[model samples]
Target: ISSHVHYSGTREDRSSRVVETIEFTTDRGQTVRANPVVSDTGTVDRSGMSVTVLHDRDRPERFIAPQNGHGISARVPVMRIGFGLLFLVVIGIIVNGGRMILGQLPFF
Candidate 1:
């Protein structure tokens, strides 16, 4: 697998993106090139990295690279906690606003 960094947009709005290309030989002795599956960290100058390719039995050209799967990482948990906190804050604001509106009502 070959990884390359691609830049898009003008100077003001430029963004960097990583693309991974995989070259493999099919059973029929045909060389095929396809994009490999990559994780978010795949773009960090990890060029010429070796990756395991899982190809389709019928269509050898169609393939995917599964990222290493284990338990939850620190990044995911932090994101979840942040989103949960944001949700709670929003819910709390809505409930507080409703309570304020009900307090203004003539009927307690």
Candidate 2:
């Protein structure tokens, strides 16, 4: 079923979190209400919009929202920068070690 979504708050890095509750019935006649948190993106605020949810038959409590993967995550860019810095550090160490070894050679 569809439920209204509201912006709960933002993450540590200032990324927004949009949360919505999904109500559904399980195969075993169990009623489950799942609240799925998604990233708030786009030019408009989706606070009043409804969200769709998909649940596992075996485990009704385990559910997911289609919008979860719809946008680029806030962590992607930061992770890329972190990896790039790590690569540079590794290359610097390798180059320095190679220079030290080659400098020990008697041949000019």
> lDDT of candidate 2?
0.62
Task: Name the runs in model 2 displaced over 4 angstroms.
Answer: 1-16, 26-29, 37-45, 68-108
Which 10 consecutive positions of candidate 2 have the poorest summed lDDT?
37-46
- lDDT, candidate 1, 9-79, per-residue tens: 99999988777777878677878788754344445554576656667767766766555433223676689
Q: What lDDT is reached at residue 25 by model 2?
A: 72
Query: Over all chains combined, what TM-score does candidate 1 have?
Result: 0.53
* Model 1 ranges with Cα > 4 A deviation: 9-13, 37-41, 69-108
lDDT of 2 by residue, 1-108 (tens): 334434444565454333556676766899987664443343233445555555667876876655553543567679899999999999999999999999999983
Q: What clash count goes with each model?
A: 0, 0
**What is the C-alpha local distance difference test score of candidate 1?**
0.71
- RMSD value for candidate 2: 7.0
